[model samples]
Target: MTQVNKALTAFQVPIIDVTTDEAIFEGEGWDAVVVIATSLAEIKQDEVSLLAAHASQIDFRVGKSATLLFAPGLAGGRLIISPVTDSDNEYSDVRIFAKAAREGIAIAKAAGATKPLLVVPSVTDNRFANAEQVAALACGQELWQPLEARESKSLQPSLTAIGLLNTATHSLLLNAAESGRVLARDLCGTEPERMSAIGFAQYCVDAFADSGLAVSVVDQVEQLKAQYPLLSAVGRSSFDVARHHPRVVKLEYVGEGPITKTLFFAGKGVVYDTGGADIKVAGSMAGMSRDKGGAAAVAGLMKALSILKPKGIKVIAELGLVRNSIGSDAFVTDEIITSHAGVRVRIGNTDAEGRLVLADLLSHLRLQAQTAVNPQLFSVATLTGHVVRAYGGYPALVENSAAKKQGVAATLAEVGQLWGEPFEVSRLRPEDFDKIADKNGAADVVSSNNGPSSITARGHQYPAAFLIKASGLTETELAFTHIDIAGSAVEGDPLYGKPTASPLVALLQFSN
Candidate 1:
């Protein structure tokens, strides 16, 4: 991420011809400025070390040519095209390939030419069309990242477009992604001491404010109790023990003039889950800081929605902001808790706290949406290992309503294509997913019929459908699509060497 001005030229990297054995000279200049290369062939690692050294110095001289300003290497069969439109061709602006195209734009523009040009070798289809995205890699580079770990982490791909039109579009997409990542940095760095429930809520509130979205925070135990009981209940115990207060966070993004269609999103924002009375073992609680991943994703999605400003869609979101820790007044197992929508739930295990938070928030969203035009509400969470184990971490689990004849399936397919991950949507017929301990104590209507009995009984897909339905929504019309990002929420890639941006792609797909 150095310098990408706008859409200019392209460096076509495909084999000159599929059948031809001929190739361009390694490090051959793509244009008067940019150099196309994979390696120097003669020297190993030397070129990479040199490039890394020259990455910072604006005055460093790699060549005697006046046009040469910055240097970036190329890959196989692909020659970096310079001056994308005039002498070269730009690649597709697809988000998946954006990392590649953006990198290319940055280096080419850095060339010393007064009006230095950047090029992408080939032209791509509409699937890759994003102007701001190109500019992000080309122009914003470091501005996008606000985390220690991701500061110098070179993301993959480069962007190259042709005129101002291409440049603008690429630049916008890049900024949107950067803006989202800055939110991610806040999410990724959640440590218990500094990143308490209140701190995390402040981070979310600030993000929405920066994005021009409206937000409200209910801070203090009494305020939290009067507003959000579930959030208050879980954290109240901890606050009394440590003398730290709790808060209830809500964000609303009003789109267009007078909302026409509305969608409600809810998340379990447990900044830290210590299992309260039912404690988690050392290893189980290791990554508890990431327990609030669902909250972070929801906040990120809200920011993306505000920036994109899709004219027709308006969204109302609720986050169950709290920390689940052990204390004298901690919520104990088997305790009957009343949710925002008045649904009575029996706490089977205190460790399964994400659902408790989600249950209350989900029920509340349904009620809120009922007052709007065509309520299309959904909930996302890192809830339940049953769905995770069912999908095997690669697939994203959505309820039967999601895969219905509606466009949800197609939209999901389009988004998942960006990162190339599997999405196995779990299908549900009825209340069959409810975990049944025995026919004796459980209510017959709520209990599952002869289904498999495992701790995996209540998966995110079916239970979400049921929870919303309990709020009086029909399976077909309610538009309840629950996404459990247990495994897919965070992705592990060798190329990235850490988790890449996932829920951003997922969230954009639905909201857009």
Candidate 2:
């Protein structure tokens, strides 16, 4: 076990709005100026061009990557020029700006500057309409220190505030979204004991304090077992330990105006997945602590929506936080368990516990959708490795029949692409349903096949089918989307990489 220090606050970073070019040098206490653009020649702002030209003259790396130059006239006498490369390439997207902004912010932080003014010139390209916001968020993504690092004082907080220069996007909104991302990353990236099922719920409760959202944590043993049976079965072994008991954190937000659209989300928060009876052998379980990315991301969405307070939209979320530990009480393969929806599920593999957790949560959301106004339901989870194999570093959306009919997945994919959080739309096939059907009709559905999802055919798509059946969602035509964030949840090294908070921005933009 490691010594854990918890953060006292949820969001500590502040975003300041810089509306004029003069502010780059003299206004709002900015210490360093960071200009990120596709090309330096495209920059028409006189003040920005002055610094850009100066850096280009002294260093050849000016337009290639993140370049820092000594400028006496600028704030703190420091200027950093970050260029977005490969924008003109046939397959490039707006993520180039995100990559450059991260690099620029990194250099600024290393240079001992506390406040950096981020300048992103407006582009006529509709594809990059949200470039300014994306770059601003990229900076937050880069500067975010893990919860443990901050609590233990191993890594000190760097930036006091970030200046978004001459932009149309509101600073408050960017900060709101970044705040949620920070919360999401903290919840997803922490170690198992530090952010166990109970710890995760408490963090959310604290984060939502005075935020005008209805928050409740369901940890009563009998209550959770009655309401989330499938989820309980996953956490069965850990029930003996008070800290590791399963929790279903329920949250709701109703806007000021008449509700036109209602969104319900189910998040899979498997705090640590030891794979149960089908234990992850060899080195496969090193990064299992991050299995809760889905639940973390959904919580983040609600946090952002609470701050933005977009009218005519109502949001409800349920996070299934549990640990699948290997012990005497652990649920094993081929065991039959009834879900909260009363569907009989035969556990085919204990490692496939994330879907079980989601199924019960989605079942609850399905019931709520029955009486809601224009409801859209979604399940977000790091449910399978096949998604990573199918689409590397991109979340995949698998929509039910009703969602496909309404073009829900297509809409999210388009919005995500423009916002630099790209998604792959996966279809639900009849074969997927067939894969979950019990060969002997012994149970309503089989949880999963015995093989690892990364090696199984249609590994990622079939779970959506099982979720639909087990959750009894087929009883209605409500639009439901299962988002698989297995690959996109973390970047670079899967074991130690930073949580990317994928699909959070895309979902927020779509909700707005």
Candidate 3:
């Protein structure tokens, strides 16, 4: 059998490794050079010493200063000096290093350097050493080329760490960045078919083919109708309107030994959500392509884990790939549908299709866990705009157990401080579940209640409750957490309000 390569060829961070003895400035062909200093003495002795002629031109006292100087005799080459404080020595504090790297890359780009060099003087400190590579990866942001056939103008820069370079640390940083690059490309790229439900499943299957993962894809509605009616209903709507089919992609990673715990991750993969028969306004449907951010994240996590090969814990991912488009065949408001878990659901609004897809996927996962020894569930989705309104640019986390919730919250908080991807914890109250109950003898429960009495502002919780019920697990029986990444998945910037592929760093850190 021919093996499929899951490795990404586009949007990769090009890293050039250099030994300590190599003089970074020896090459006359270089466009620019970046020198990072930890102390004032190092700023004067180590960094500034290389450019003694222009030492007097720069004020080296300020921390985090990026000074661009021209070398007169060296054919007008540019040199950038960035300073760091002693307090920023915490290796665990990724922000300090990432910030310094971002500054270095910005300065290099401004100097018109297609291939600049980064030099960190104090490499004995692991933080400084890691910072060099972090800067190189951050420089990737400048060199990033989206999925376009057009030629890219981005540059691939090199770096040199003065102290002993930890090869393992360098590999880890590069791997993490590579994983992130795949996500960014998937989220930000403009491939409508590739981002579609069926296309996304194909992407996952190709990606994990050679990664030792067991992949299964259910693409037709007929195959899923009896077992996953909710998912089938949502996906069938897009068949006539968008000519897109839905699919459920499952990936499993099992270790050699007796697996003690199984981790199941479900991502809502509504490739293009047009709010079905209810329909979304122009503004609401403008960026509907990003509705698959949750599945993109899951694919990214599985990619990283496949490379990292974490032991003992088996990982399973269920990506529910479907499109909710409006047409005569689309599921509409006030329609009743029986889910795979045997729960009768009334479609209060067709826009609430993400939870419906997840409901069936989670139900399947619950059944899988019955045979497995110990199982923990996690669901990620861009469920509602209410979460974006409440948290602005942060993900809302809802966990069944308070203790487990606090632990994950604390871990995520620490990771957030370092990575700048914060998540807020939302309560999964009993009233939330009570509201989803068959109130008017209409159905087992309403899929969504966007009416006046409905808790629309706290809409993130309602879906969480509905999913828990769909999973066929009591809140106390299984450990489950829901992550609503509606706001954090995309950038808030006006000009580039694109998908950011967030929480990848946080999730990777938590898994570690």
Residue 305's lDDT in candidate 1: 74
lDDT of 3: 0.67
For each candidate, what TM-score against the reference? 0.67, 0.97, 0.82
Candidate 3: list runs displaced more than 4 Å: 1-7, 16-23, 27-32, 35-45, 48-65, 71-78, 82-100, 110-137, 149-168, 241-243, 255-260, 402-406, 451-455, 493-498
- Which regions of candidate 1 deviate over 4 angstroms? 1-168, 241-244, 392-395, 400-405, 418-422, 431-462, 469-477, 493-501
Name the candidate that leads on lDDT: 2
Residue 490 displacement in candidate 3 (angstroms) = 2.0
Counting clashing residue pairs in each candidate, in order, gives: 56, 0, 0
lDDT, candidate 1, equals: 0.51
Q: What is each predicted model's overall lDDT from 0 to 1?
A: 0.51, 0.89, 0.67
- CA RMSD (A), model 3: 4.7
Candidate 3 lDDT over 1-512, as tens digits, reads: 22213235433544555454233343544456566656435543343455633464465433447667765433126666665545444434444555566676677666676566565555555334345555555555445444433224442222221121223345554555555556544643445565677667766777666778888998656788888899888977676644488888898887667777787889888888788877777575777777888888877777777777766778888988888877778877788898888888888878888999998988888788767767778888888778877777779888776426446556666665555456788877888888788778878788888552124756787788888876565534667788898887766452235455666766766665
- lDDT computed for candidate 2: 0.89
lDDT of 2 at 306: 86
385-459: candidate 1 lDDT, tens digit per residue: 566666655445464464355666556756654433335666555554444222344321131222221244545
Note the residue pairs that clash in candidate 3: none
